[model samples]
Target: MYPLLEVHLDIIGENASKVLRLCEGKGIDVVGVTKGCSAFPEVAFVLLEAGIKILGDSRLDNIKKLRRAGVACPLMLLRIPMLSEIRELVELADMALVSEISVVKAINEEARRLGKFFKVILMIDMGDLREGIWPINLLSYLDSIRSLNYVELLGIGANFGCFGGVLPTPESVSMLINYASLAREYTLSDIPIVSVGGTVALQLLEEEK
Candidate 1:
């Protein structure tokens, strides 16, 4: 007999609904991350049906797949984009998480060439030690990003538990919010989004209950 894996999408949808409801109450919108499932359209559909308006993935290929499948909701690139893939990333992703000024510049240049605007979420390193700019260097990056003509600073985000095994705490969350405030002040624009949650954060919430 061949090995088989069964995916119970009904249960997944129910859980997604619960999380969506909780986030909605707190004025938070959830971005359903599909990298774990390779951005399978079926699972992505379940998340959308459960009220996830934006879909996020770590791979540009997965984003392309979702687009090919006709999932028109806003797609987010969860990983820091590579400079070489800037052109395709600009076309496939509605928004992307970025930490480096060079990559942002590349994206901006490509967006200019394509005659399209691109959105970016600056990533701050809030004790995660993962893919993000150091808190001390944020202002410099913000200054550079603000001067860009084609790329819009959508907001900020921080990774937790993905690397360095740092657990998400209230203090960490507060730090991210503080950085978001600083970004808004420095950019002189209302940086609307502050993405600071992940599976570990969700598990923390579950443990609190």
Candidate 2:
């Protein structure tokens, strides 16, 4: 047991609260991302107690773990899901980030089978080239998925600094905001979660401009 890891739950809770308060005053809602910590239950619980509205993880198994521990906030799948795991994704996550039309269709079918309507954020690739549809293809792709009754289009988002190392700037985030507007225009409704970030996007918030 010499290599055993140690965690201070109370300290984590305090730190999370301070960060959440800072983000909150600036009108930002924080999602406690548990992937880096491998979704440790104690740490995740501390984040929950610190008031994150959503718990986000890249793996379905991690989200499942959080749910089994009775974490009550809405759970979000940070990574785009695979077609094979649509059923699990539907069962476990309240919302997911998605790009491919085929995967979206699978999720729709799975949601219909499960008698649940799942929420989704369409990811736009603003040069990071990781997991989003290209901006030019966004509107048309939205049109294709607009009729998906079992899937509620929650909002739009983008990923940067993950693969391509493209840093998020005010200009790039503005582009994401514009895409969200375009999505609303197509649907003629208010988009709920314009999630335009990952961990790196935090830099945008910390900046005074």
Estimate the TM-score of every prediction.
0.95, 0.95
The candidate that achieves the highest lDDT relative to the unseen native structure: 1
Which 10-residue span in candidate 2 carries the lowest summed lDDT?
Answer: 200-209
Candidate 1's C-alpha runs over 4 A off are 203-209
Residue 188, candidate 2: alpha-carbon lDDT: 90
Error of 1 at 121 (Å): 0.9
Model 1, position 176, has a per-residue lDDT of: 88
In model 2, how large is the Cα lDDT of residue 124? 90
Kindly give the number of clashing pairs for every candidate: 0, 0
Over the stretch 1-209, how does candidate 1's per-residue lDDT look in tens digits? 99998888999899899998777767778999999889889999999999899999999999999999989999999889888888899888888999999999999999999899999999988776888988899999998999999999999999888788888787888888999998888778999999885767776455552
lDDT of 2 by residue, 7-38 (tens): 88888899899889778887878889999888
